[model samples]
Target: MNYEDLFIQYQNLEKSLKDKTKLLAKLEKAISKEMEGGDISRCITDTAVMKSVSAEVTSLLQEIESLVSSFDGKEYIESGDFVSQMLEQCAENGVDVTGSSPNFEMFPNKVRIDVENQDIYLDRKKVACLRPVVLVQAIKKGQEKLLKASFNANKFASELIVAYDLALADLGKNPGTDLYLQKLYNYMVPMSRFRKDYDLQSYAFDLARLYAVGSSVEIKDGRKIQWGTSRDGKKGIRILDGNGREEFLATIRLF
Candidate 1:
């Protein structure tokens, strides 16, 4: 694709990802609502909604897999366009090609890359991996709904927090839940910051105001966090950090 065409395609992909994300959010909300009123945890794992979510999730996973595997190079991570070629490069570079997400333990012969911590492991041991780049993209595609709930600066902030707390509590006793909770928190930090800074009060009156306008936060210098508008008149939210770009903790859509 030409530069313009590629750009357009990229944008289109983003939009498609966003749509899938909204659907996932709605599904999650349905599950959460059902669980909140009563105990449906057992039913949730096999519910139609959950199955649909899993299917959509699988599709999103494929997209992320495609995008991440498109690059294969020893010097630069973005070197190849084919997954097989990337695997060959990994073999050539002595970088172990481990099994990936949804099955971190199935393949024993290769190193394992854990999506929860964005880290790599060799035979159940930690290995040096600067993986925040791939992680940011993957999380963005897989957990859009959580990101939205986390980033909401409006009326849903309190409710979102409650739902998140419930999820953590419910999953706290379960080992499998911890990993997912960790991933959820990693993506929610930026969103939490937006809610905390953007809206001061939490009373009914204040909540009404908070609900009226939702904004985003951006980080500058990776330390300083700020909110407001962009140069092109896109009104949402942003933040700045003083320490420069930190690893991608989370991403919140401005629109």
Candidate 2:
């Protein structure tokens, strides 16, 4: 009915949208795990269900995006504007507006504008009072977390190659060298923990191939290459170029 009522309604809708988004994301992840069964008929049925859930999630996301866009034209008045409006209204009604009145109180310093809700309120009140800059920073931080959670090395394989090339060039040693490989493993361990199917030896060999010296090696057909050795005297495969020249491959340390 009024600006205050509309602002409250908008705030409630925003909160509801965020809650629904999180729930839907969890549901999608659960359904995806369930879809990995080996039964063909059941897999087909799961695919259809997944499609329905995905469509619903997409529609909700579009609605939320549209709602956020609509807020651009809405007026966001600061404390000064609020005070000026109150003074003008008081002057029109022949009431004194210079001094603090019994009915009206203002906390100029404590007042903050909530950009999302398009409302102003005192900081002392137990209510959401996020500034626009703070809200943007919060959103960016959440997005960064989401990005990290969904990280996949295959998605940034080129970037990894470039990083290895730079590191090798700067250090004047092959990335497959024992010292650099250990350093790389230490750096990657924390990030690799987030991966569901992470294998340290497999990743180490993959990294070995990216090294300038190891890039010339070719894998033998029907032969599984070992990346690390055991204390029982079992040795790992030696890399060889097309010209039959031996190349160095990193011997991973299990510890």
Candidate 3:
């Protein structure tokens, strides 16, 4: 064919292909709408089927929650002795201890609780034997109750309040630590910015735990330690190596 004729034919074919693609897209869209009961945005399913499935799922969830809630708090407390109680408490709190060693770790409220060599560690520091019990109680009371209790007590509550205030003051500073503050606020101020009632003991427990987790601390020879804030305003664990160089270990975040 002549060049002009060939070029015209090529243009016509391209146009035809484009038209066909458009038609195919329109057809597919129509089919999808039909399958989706006239709504292309939704999935194809019988309304009755969806309702039945939802009801079943809701029922199962309720049953599961009921079974879980029925558990007496004493099951872990009365398991065996102090060590056994600690282990049981860890298990009940979803902390796994089935590994090869006696060291076990759990993340509740994004805070790490490590049971190493049968000693409980919160924020990597060895804590009292009653730490687990207090932790569990704080969790049960909810975050706000824990925060209020923590703030009310004269313990390490000031640090958290200061952090929270600093976060609020800047609104863009230390975004990493903001997660921890948000978690506390979500628990303490669910609807409004003010809630007066709180559990004192639970607050104290939560304060100690948060302080241990969110504060910057030094690990010396992996034994004796000093807890304080760094000059940079970032909180994390710092371990000193043999060369006396400080190494960043990990930052505690709200999980």
Model 2 score (lDDT):
0.42
Note the residue pairs that clash in candidate 3: 110-255, 144-187, 144-188, 149-203, 150-203
lDDT score at residue 128, model 1, on the 0-100 scale: 54
Regions of model 2 farther than 4 Å from truth: 1-36, 72-74, 78-255
Encode model 2's per-residue lDDT on 1-255: one tens digit a residue. Answer: 123444665677667667656766765666566666545665566566667756765776676576556543224343334344444544454332223321232211123444445554432333342233333333345434533454333433444434444555666865454333444443444465654344443343344343323323333222222344323312332332234334444453111
Model 3 ranges with Cα > 4 A deviation: 1-45, 79-82, 85-255
Q: What lDDT score belongs to each candidate, Candidate 1 first?
A: 0.39, 0.42, 0.41
Worst lDDT window (10 residues) for model 3? 217-226
Order of candidate numbers by TM-score, starting with the best: 2, 1, 3
Q: List TM-score per model, in order.
A: 0.24, 0.27, 0.22
Best by lDDT: 2
What is the TM-score of candidate 1?
Answer: 0.24
